[model samples]
Target: MITIKVPCSSANIGPGFDVVGLSLSIWLTLQVNIVTTTTTTDTTPPPHTLNCNITYEGEGASHVPLAADANLITRTALYVLKCHGQRTFPRTTHVHIVNPIPLGRGLGSSGAAVVAGVLLANSVSKLGLSKDRMMDYCLMIERHPDNVMAAMMGGFVGSYLRELDPADMERKEIPLAEVLPEPAGGINTGLRPPEPPLGIGHYIKFGWAKEVKAVAIIPDFEVSTATAREVLPEVYSKKDMACLSPITGTSGIFNLQRLAVLTTALTRSPPDAELIFQAMQDKVHQPYRKHLIPGLPEILASVTPQSHPGLLGICLSGAGPTILALATHNFEHIAEMIMARFKQEGITCRYELLEPAYEGAQVIES
Candidate 1:
């Protein structure tokens, strides 16, 4: 039996888009066992038989597939086993899942599942695979590393999808290909790699400033990642790329200034309160996504540097609906302000104060 505990995460982080993510304290737990159901007590055949039973406890418990074949954890575990050269997929396996992290809510529940599967595979097989290797498989599964990177490594992570040498790969991002399965001739036959080299490199580039608190201004309504993605235009216009004129002596480029301040907030040790608010502004996804979240404009309008003291920045978390904010103090006030605005506009929502999870997924039992 093996148990995996993976922290939930938030991706995008304003201008970082798919490149940045931060892990929160919330978690998803998974327990997997290789055993047979009581109905088939016979130790009959040479073939190892396994029965699968899955249970969910929170969040998407009622909706996530209970059947092993349809479950994300089960499928991912099977794939990892196959990649590790398992002659046959497990026919009798038991899975018990507890998901506190909300699903399809820009809270990284999928990333948690991916990390859970890979880590479960590593533990059950006693394959001393490193976290870096696990992240590789997770990246292959997601095609992006923002959520998985934070879930796997924790802290404030920044990543890029590109090629790099082994050493550089290790430093720039978690190496997914750390352990490759090879057959008789030593030529690897299993684990079909991604068609394109979607190698992602990431690390904890910075930390939050001031006595920071991450607040999730989550709404009652849900927004599917697919819908949010579909709403975005496929291309950008010249105006979108246009930077501020050189005339202002560096004042013209809006997002660049924001990115700089955001980076400073992260890189600097004690986070700079001066930079937090500006850092949270975005030019990429929010403009197009505002329509999906009810009362977003009102919520933004309600809070400002003058109106809400200590409030850093507030913006979309990953896609839509949930608006994550940063603040040095007055958490309850911020929450109340956001909640009041939503209520007045007739938008139902909830808020959660989150802290950065400094560590990634771990094995609680083996």
Candidate 2:
């Protein structure tokens, strides 16, 4: 049997929404084995027949459909095998899955499933699929390459979609070309353990700064990707863009030179109090998205960088609800302060500090 473990991910940090993503240490494991017989009693139709069995564990276990053909991971794995010229199955492949990533929480649970499928097929079939090729198929399946890139690459990945050449397709005559990223970005990331207690009335914050503690704040709420996309406006005015000048720069030329420097410092070196505070400025996207998340701006305003002594920058995880903060080594003190600040704002939320996962997905024999 081939066993693979895939990490969970978070996408879209402030201005880089749908573009930036980070893979976390959290993981889901899949075990697949080839079953040569359909019946244990030796009453099978033929010697070359195949049968399959599936088992699931952890989060989403109750929700995952039992139909193997309809299961996303199973279907994708089967598809990968077929694409590699294995049109027929002589033996059934039994699959067992263990998952922990939260679904539909902007945590990239679906991305993990897609990644596992691709990896499982390649390993079981001995296809020798390169990481790039696997990522290509996964990106195609995800409909968003950012999350997949982070999942595959296992760090902070920044990616943006660009139009593909229609002429290339015209020459080959293919329809529905894929959406992909020109490049990707990421850094080793993590979440604080002692897994924070889940309850209402907790404090939450989001955005950038020096010396930041990334508390991955999540709520007991479900928000669909479609719903979140629908809430975004189609256009913004010149005046509206003008409002971001101070945060962007004095000239507001759209060059967040200081902000980029801050990000570079944190990734190049280990995240510290100075780096977190330095990275805490967002002149873009946050204003536009504030309407979607009401408590965000208030949280940002409430957490004074140096005044808090240990807090640095704060930013949202993927979509809505999950907030991450960058902080100093003295996170406990700042965490308490953060709770107090959010309470005063009348915004109750929960948080967990996360670390970056340096390794991507992997499969091991059992």
Candidate 3:
């Protein structure tokens, strides 16, 4: 049996939006066991039998569509199997998914499933696909490369788009280069790069694993991506742009200044209440997306005032009703305090203290 354990991920840590993501240890584990086909002169069940059973558990099992052809993860695996030239399903394969990740709340639950699908296919087929290639396939399926990278590579990753160079592919002979192809042809053709392309992509590492513990507070309601995108204005006046200069200036958020801001904020306060609260400031996305998140003001005000000294930063997790607060170390007391603060607001929320997962997604034999 091939068991694929994929980490859950949270993207857009405040200002990063689509460009930044972090993975948590909590995972959705998928176990697939291939059933034996016919034996020599003996009657054995045939592989790919229509009677093969697929089961899902944990987070969204009931809601996840049951038909193998309709299931997202199953479909993804099938795609890979087809790519590997496997026309038939393995006989009586039993598939199980244990999910801890929440869906559509900006915690990357979907990305985990996509990753799970690709990894499961690779393992079952024994197709020795390279990690980079597998990552590319997963990312293409996910469409959010940064989050996919975090789900695949683990830990904290910062992504920025760059033109794909054709020379990079002369060695691999990848038929499609727009994703990682010759820069000139792909760029000229206006063909967008595929989601979740190969390599770790253009990314950088920040902070240590033990040094970070993230607190994710998810509100009850869901927000549509379209609505959140609409909240972003298409244009801003030069004066409004000028007003943003300081935040966008040499020490702007787009740079390491954002992290510096958090570090500085935490350093100044008593390390209990003041420092951590001050560190949550954002000049970029939060201020804009707040409109979409109900009770955000109350949630923010509550968490900020009761901040723990160990806290590094706090910001929206994607287009969120989910908020992520990061810390320099384990802060159980602080976490309880924060959770209490939110609970008092009567918001339906759950919190988990998680470290940066650096291993990404992988298969475990069961």
Instruction: Judging by lDDT against the true structure, name the best candidate.
Output: 1
Each model's lDDT:
0.71, 0.59, 0.64
Q: Write the per-residue lDDT of candidate 1 for residues 1-366, one digit (tens) a residue.
A: 777889988888877788788888898888777653445534653232223567788987667877543567755654566666663334455667988887777888888888888887777666687887667677666767888898888888877766766665545432334323222221233345332123455465466543777898777777888898888889966466445566764434456567766866765556555476667777777778878877776666567666788777787888767778777788888888888777886877788899988777888765
The C-alpha TM-scores of every prediction are 0.83, 0.74, 0.75
Q: After TM-score superposition, what is the CA distance of residue 122 in candidate 2 from its true location, in Å?
A: 1.6
Q: How many backbone clashes does candidate 2 have?
A: 45
- CA lDDT, candidate 3, residue 257: 46
Candidate 3 structure quality by residue, lDDT tens digits, 23-102: 88788898788866645343654333332467878776667876555566776666566555564356557887788887
lDDT of predicted model 2: 0.59
Q: Rate residue 28 of model 2 by lDDT.
A: 82
The better candidate by lDDT, 1 or 2, is 1
Candidate 1 residue 207 C-alpha distance from true site, Å: 2.9
Off by over 4 Å in 3: 39-52, 165-200, 224-227, 235-256, 259-280, 305-307, 328-346
Q: Which portions of model 1 miss their true places by more than 4 Å?
A: 33-50, 87-92, 164-200, 245-253, 267-270
Candidate 3 structure lDDT? 0.64
Between candidates 1 and 3, the TM-score winner:
1
